[model samples]
Target: MEKYVPEKDERAPSAADTTALPTSSNERTPSMILEDLSDSGRPATEEEIKTLRHVTDQIPLRVWLVAIIAAAERFTYWSTQVTWQNYIQYRPDDEIPGILGLGQATAVTVNNAFNVVVYLLPLIIGPIADGKLGRYRTLQICTAFYLAGTCILLGCSTTPAVEAGAALPGFVVALCLTSIGLGGVQTVTTPLIADQYDETVAKIAYRKNGERVVIDRDMTIHYVYSIYYWMANAASLGMILTSLLEKYISFWGAYTLTTGVLLLSVFILWFGKPYFVLCAPSGTVIPRAFRVLWIATTSKFKLDAALPEKQLECGHEVPWDARFVKDIGSGLMAVKVCLAWPILRLCVGITSSNSIAQAGQMQTGGVPNDLLMASNAIALVLIGLVVENGLYPFLEKHRIPFREMARIATGLFFMAVSMAYGMIVQALIYKAPPCYNFPLECQGSDGRIITEPNHINVLVQLPLYILVAVSEVFAFVTGSAYAYKKAPPNMKSVLQSFYASMSGVGYLLAVALGPASKNPGLVVLWGSVTGVMGLTAMDNGQTRKDPVWHGPFAHDVPNSISAFMSQYSALSLIRGLTSRTCTYELKGVNFAYLPLARPHAVENSQPSQKALSPGLSDPASDNVHDRPSGTLDIPEGYISTGNYIPNHNIVPTSALR
Candidate 1:
């Protein structure tokens, strides 16, 4: 109950108080009440700011429910999306109708265009979620559009009107609607999950086995994102089936399977509504944050990181509080890091979109080009586990903290190397090929034109895929956490949108570079990508409020659908659909989605109360609110408002266990 009101006597903490925080467990026992009050808009003293990274918290079980919803969504989106490239580029004259069979150049262009729409839509949708509809409501509306879009596309493939080589207009319409839905779902989902946790305090916690530790907001969020990332990748493994389905069965089957998953996600979200702690949109948070940024940039304001408590005077009067000014500073720092992503992500674009194209050129030993992504997904899952649990903790223990910026730089380096690797692969493919330009027409002994793959092994492409996964581990995964950690709480979704937008920018640039994916330009394309990525390489971050990862597209699917990823993805890359006509291609965003699962403040279920681990105790300050006698049963800092007042019957935090 000791809400942070400045003391009338001392202006700030004394030099002695500013000394390093307690290193031993006995020296630093935090009070849950004090920590809870700190979360309720309490200002940090100078010293607290410096040591913030040292603490982390246990991710609540409720957050996992939200993660599950995102997983289901990833499963559905990928179930059908991994088939975009082949559906557009490969002409099926003998097998089935090649509906709207645009050439490879046109198809990749369309794919880029679709990606641009999906990534950019977040800008529009983010504001709406924060101002008009809340995140939960926004998700519902978006999911409907997503489902409808899939249904329309499904009918396009199944209807009798689509003749062999004929174009389907409904198909384009479906992509548009789904774009909005995808954009809307992505912008709101991550932020919504973040809001579910009680991030008001950090405490000295223990591993389930009694090892002493610190649990704070940053670690808690990082943990949630790690789990969120792993779940999304796990769901992506489903795309293997969808790829086979679209190849062997019908596009209708693939799209239908997707719709079913989408429906499942929607169902989970609706039924579990009561369990969630819905966040009301904070009006115009993004606008205000940007305004602060502008004011800070243009004005004569000087920032001294060592003294955040002493607000510097603004260069211009925009009527913002000191806290708002600090938030703007934080926002700008994040953006500075993010600016590098536009280039770094291009490597991802090349590998995810163009590499799949490259695979199509080389002779496949009966394995699908998109199947290589199974390696990427599996690598990401394992990396996530190893890095977050094994590596990160180990580093922290050794006092060699793994910085986010450094992680991002390393990721960029991986992208550079991967691009270079692809460049080499492309060169070798040309050297060994019968058709030098690939998909080349070779003359048989009888003089009939034979379309055969080059002699290069398809598995040679594994390094590039593995590199992309490794890059994601460092760049994409860490970036998401960094964005969440660095972004102003109110402007979190906006920051995430900023992160997602980089992919769109990269893809747009990729469209311009689409020609590079072709013959002589293949070397130039990969070489240029390598050079650009290496040159612009910088530290960065990604998110739901954190970036989500998506995978590449596949064409045909079997009984299973496909796996689509988000920002570790933009998630639309892997999805391809088979068109008997091969004339049309459906490219969608591959971001994962999950049904919403909120934990209610019920006993023996999930705890809605702020949890404080053992060995933590708050100072019995004079200003602290008096606890009601015998109502010790009430959850700590339980603010009774609306209809309910504190009563003896109220359940305590102990009731959670």
Candidate 2:
């Protein structure tokens, strides 16, 4: 392997310029960049080699606690939220008795509004976790709020107060409490799970296989989060249970069950406090971020600040440190990775609500209504396991990587792909034997009444559910992993909250199409959603190609090229084409990707050697002096490899050498 350095100062280049073709000296053909492992480590001992086995092998125990906390919270959130439309909107019948008995429009409106609040609250709470209350404490407080809300709803639902529209105001109050709590906890806990392992501390040992393996941080983080999602879905088993309770027992039973779960979660969180590695709150990055941007902007206009260095230095005698500026750049690049998330989520808002409503319309022989909507959560658990345990390890062993940007793009494509299935299901529903126009009370051709439902089975929707599940694993699980990896040490919760907010933004978009949600208009709406999502997928690809702020991603395409090549790989797919899923209920509602910059792990210079290694750094360097990690300063290349990164590209490793 050879050293390659950029001729220009890499810090200030626009995204387009940095990503444009590299100068010849540093440029590697896709072939040259695909060379063999260039590690300088000594041969592994037998005992060391024995330990190297699987990517999922050695996670710490506390990580599971965080996963439990996530799962419990998700269960409570989904159990209640899943039954909302039927509980609030559908007219009362023996099989499906109403709580609020509000009209369909009211249910949809309230649900959408509640979703907006649940997702949006993270924006405020994230800073609180980062700046004041540490993650562990914030998690505790937020969860208490969730428990409190569940108790309130349980009380209101069980008592006579819930009889009519009387319970409506109380329900609104409950929604507020749960949304604020759930949003903050969701945003903060993902980073909390990730923080369990130390990435910078790579503990290398020889595997029993005689091949040395790193107890790798990045891949471990990815794997833990995959399980995190799968576990949450498993916990969301509440969807089926609670919905059943609503249908058979009473709506109060479901709320009671959810409250119990939240209470248990709170206990476990506090019980395990001694074991958790709780990092204290680092002050908020957003305020510092604003100041940095302001300084960068003002310096651009000042006549005295001609040089890039001068611009950076101008007011920085004002508390703006170099690393903080670098962090802002990193955060921006992460934004590019997820920039398409909100727009992508528009499809989610449309489908989830519509799916529930459509199921309500289904002529089920005896199937429950909540069961159909619960499919999203169920599918997440099932497909998530297959991909994580069976597929990912296989790909890693073969050196085939699923690139972050590429996986997210695949998720976006599947968002559109799932819709295609939805369109088919809708069309089938229209053509079913019952009155196609029955929602409007249709009269048959022979003057006979078409009283019964069209005989089409609700099971036809299984395919769409499966497709959506596959998409969720591909998109959402990986998206959480990506956010954690790319976030700055201090601002992890804030970055994650930004990622979570995309769902709200997407729902905001979906809210615009509210009028068309009813029957007769639904088929047209689904078909339109499919088309728009496909275009959005293409747009996401373009964002991966070039982002707005141009920090980390602009400089880092090479590392992702192979990983992304999986979607484009010949005949090797997870499950048909749409397996690349993104985001979750609120979480899945966001994501896209761009490259990220690696900080100083790349160079070969000795710590003691102040002198350059020939063509490497200059003795008279123009860049500001960096605080030492003791490694010699080597600016990172655009593409840095990840643990499971693949040799998926057509070019052979042998060809590169």
Candidate 3:
């Protein structure tokens, strides 16, 4: 091994460096000590900083196994999910093959309602996984429900069950069970897969190509999620097979194949148990979180007051400690970041249900309307590959920061564009001869109701699906990565579920708008969705100024420090702090968790403020009231102000103002 050797003429360590030393003997290795010793911890030289590149670590085999599990689950899900609209809308005697013979409005309603249930159950199941059952046990139980529900759905699809009047009720029960299964699996699976790689801090490493790079855990997570989503969309191509089976074979055959795929996922989970990283259940987080919130409220919103030492000083006791307070604060920040998701999800709900119905009203050229939904899967796979391999690498090379919030905003913009296109398509479908303003309602010469759809080709819907895919790539994948990165291990499932449940809220809105899925109202429905998404995109762009936009704690530190270090003045102060020893450490700083800049701080700034930094003045003596409303009280240089390690006390300071 190459060894680091300290120079004999190196100066003695400063008191701050000694205080910051790790207690563990293993952590104080010779290499580490020498590594610290050789450091001129003055701000990085401009050339040194400019040449830096962030890249991902090699993904583990165990993580791939988990990803395969997720892919299989998505395969089974979209197979059934995409087919539901056709299954509910048409009759066996009609041109389309279906069971229930419900109208388009009813089909839209049922499909979105199913989406609502699938997303909503995560809230109930997430806590159970986090606090009681643990991820592995919870996944196994949910898979069992998934298998049972699929079996029941297969039985309900049979001709005998339909004649016996048992099909509808059985279908309802199956939907409920399947929803539980899917929601629970989704709540636990995302975080569990991400948990396989636990390294958070970035480090300098050499690639196989012999190029030096920074192995960034955040970038690695970005790559992982991109791969995860790509696999999901690739697996969703199974919808084409299921749609074909439903058309040529039967719904029974379709359900049988999907149920088999689901079984494969279950088997993988069972077999991979030994290799997977399984975390044991950490007892109730939500209840304790509420208690911490109560403590914060009583103490005038100062979260530091919830610390165990603070509680002891006040002659009281609580179930949590200082770390848990930080966890809760981070969780809430994740929640705030996700607030715009519901509107975006509404766009997804429309694409899945109403968009399918819209396709049925256009010329399909003998292809099943449900098959067009597969276009979304195709676009997702293609776009995701290009983005992960092409776009992200380009960004990293150029050091262009395309953070999570920006990605989400880009997604919202795409969603709006997609919905606007859908509205235009609906208008064209309405304008076609024989249908004029009403599709599927025009009468023939004999005054009999005509079933023939409008003259518009179904392929026109491809652009809309392509747009939706772009949105998913930017918005949904980024959201998943954000949740996993920010959440504390114990609260991972809880936070992921809350993020997911927004989809249900969006679908529920679609369900409420069921009546608008048909005729002239289709135009209004698509237009309304377009408007909501557009406004949300604008709002999200503005949120770049918000504290939640700082991103994950790990992401904040190095980037902020590097940017701060680029200044010659900062280098001088760091050198002064080191007493010409050329070393300084930012100790006990918690600006990562603190919302430093107050509202209107950015609006009134000259060019604009860029980052928040820990101010030099002692935090314990600081008063928020003493500072100007839109000003952050930064000192001459950034430094840790006090011995605030355990409690992680906040000093609200903004830099680059």
Candidate 4:
């Protein structure tokens, strides 16, 4: 590691300068080189080495409580979403009655636009959670919004409200409120759940089988997310009940029950307040992060130049420390990792809107049109259980490295497979009907056009839903784990929001495809999405293997290389500027005094021993008079008089005063 010492120059003193301040013994300095564990402690014994295996730590009960809150929220949110296509497309006169008589195109468009709002609002709410309101309080407010929205939705869905023509307007307002609430809930929920278990290092532990294993925090986090997602999917089963309610009763009955569940989540959150590991809002964190990035950018992306001492040496003032810069690096890395998510989101998004419409156009028999959507939840629960409890443990026990990025890539590939299947299914649907290319526009025997669905069984859509579930088990869970683990503590919500925002972007893309979502163009839409997913999956895999990606949250280049390159490039540029600079025209500048100086050397006087070790200083020796004459007097707080200035043309502080 290189030590950064601020240069003595003709510059004004800055409050941000830490050169005069002594470093605390407890303060951890940033290190570039990876720590060598070879000499860290005593070598493991032969028996210990042979029996050692990585295992997860026991998740706290409080974590489960948080997961339950998320599950309940998902339950209510998805329950409303699963019924959206049906509610918007069909009417009471249709076999499967619906509230709004909008066509399939309008329904898919509405669903896509709703998703856009649902995922986009997180960007606004994330900063609020990290700054003004804590995660717990923000979540409470969001639940209120959600409950209010659900109530309005129920009110507008009544037969009288539909007859009175207020359903469309009321649906719009309800969706807007629900989107805001759900977006805010999603932004903070996962991050809050992750906050409960803060152990980062792996510790050795003994299992009930009398086997010694390393309790890996990373693996534990992975497991937590898996089970968390499992519960989320389990709650998604609420959509099945909502669908049934919509069929047997009315849309009002279904939404009324969902509102109650959302209310229960509120109570659960309130009771768990005492147990939750609540972190207070650091109001200035996001702004400070932006300022750090501004500094780094202005300094030509030389991050170290944004450091306090470096900024001071360059005659600039700054408010952050080196750690803040490191955190910025971590945050940027998280953003970079999520760049591939939009395509994946585009693929998975088909299920919520287009796939529901696709299934609705097929022969559903007595099944509700959107009821097949529950297959995704069911498959996710089954797959999550098998993968989390079975496959993950087996891999860990055998030391198989199925890292987060790899899992994400695998998930992407699975999504591609599902999309490919969807493209084929659409083609099959087009080919299987009496109407052929136009199933909804079939001509009856009397020469009148019949608008009936095709003869393809909706059950064939099962594989598509199941594959998407498998993909979620791999991609969505691991991507979240990657984001949560990479983000700095204060910026957890922001990073998670960044991750979630990809889904919004994907939904926005889906909105663009609204025109093609109907009829013969559906095949082309599915093919295009499948192609994009495949390409992104390949790109993600290549990124994982790329040496440029040092670690999950490191910079594009290795830290050591980035620092060295920045410093070398900066020094070279400075040397070029100094070599050519000879004169500057002064216009109306007042100078109190200009001092003529020459270099003074204290022969055979070694520098202070403290200079060898950065971030360490002896306070007793931190005095202006403690050093030889002509040496810079750097002391605590104030800049001492007679400090050496490298440029003689500039006036000394004492002379100027």
Quick one: best lDDT, which candidate?
A: 3
**lDDT of candidate 2 over 1-657, digit per residue (tens):** 001212121122223432453448776432332232233133434344323333333667888988888888988888888888887875455245677767555676677767777777888988899889989999989988888888888887875776554577888788888887888888789999988865444444322222335454566778888878888988987888997888778889998888888877888887899988888997876876776656545654222232245545654344555456556655655665666777667777766677876766667666676578677777888777777777767654543435566577677777888998888788877776566734424677888655456667777787787788777788887788877776788989988889888778877767777766766777898898899887767655333322222222133221122222222221222332233221111100112211223334433222333422233243353211221233232222222232111111222222335
Best by TM-score: 3
Model 4: what TM-score?
A: 0.75
Residue pairs of candidate 3 with colliding backbone atoms: none
**All candidates' TM-scores?**
0.71, 0.74, 0.78, 0.75
1-657 in candidate 1: lDDT tens per residue? Answer: 001122122222223323443456765322321232222224444334333324455456678778877887787665555666766665556222234567667667777778778878888877777777878898899988888888887788763646642335877888898888888877777776777776666543322222223345666666677778788888877777766666677566667777777787788788988888787777876665555544434433433221224334323334456566556556555655576677876676677677877876677777776666667778888877888777777755543324554567667777888989999999888888577654455677888765676778888988887787777887776677777666776777777787778777877887887765666578888998888886655312322122121111112211111111112322111111110010111122111111112211322222122332222233452111122222212122122211112111222223234
By summed lDDT, which 10 consecutive residues of candidate 4 come out lowest?
582-591
**Candidate number that wins on TM-score, 1 or 4:** 4
Off by over 4 Å in 2: 1-57, 295-309, 312-316, 438-451, 541-657
lDDT of 1: 0.60
Clashes of 2: 32
- Give the candidate order by descending lDDT: 3, 4, 2, 1
Ranking by TM-score: 3, 4, 2, 1
Query: Candidate 4 — which residues are off by over 4 angstroms?
Result: 1-51, 298-300, 541-557, 560-657
After superposing candidate 3 on the true structure, give the runs of residues whose Cα lies further than 4 Å from its correct spot. Answer: 1-51, 298-300, 541-657
* Global lDDT scores for all candidate models: 0.60, 0.64, 0.72, 0.71
Q: For model 3, how does the per-residue alpha-carbon lDDT over 1-657 read when each residue is reduced to its tens digit? A: 011122443332434544465567766533344343433222333333334455667788888887888888899999998888877888768877788888788988998888898888989999999999998899999988988999999999998998888778998999988988999889888988888877765555433222334456777887777778888889999999999998889899899999988888888887879998889999867888888878776776666678899899889887777778777666665775577778888889899998888888889998988899999999999998888788767754433445665676677778889999999999999889777677677888999888888899999888999999998998899889988877888989999999988888988898998878877788999999999887777655222112222222222221121122121221222222223111212322233122222222211122111222344334553322222244433221123332222223334233222
RMSD values for the candidates in order, in angstroms, are 19.0, 13.6, 11.4, 17.9
On the 0 to 100 scale, the lDDT of residue 22 in model 2 is 45
lDDT of 1 at 566: 16
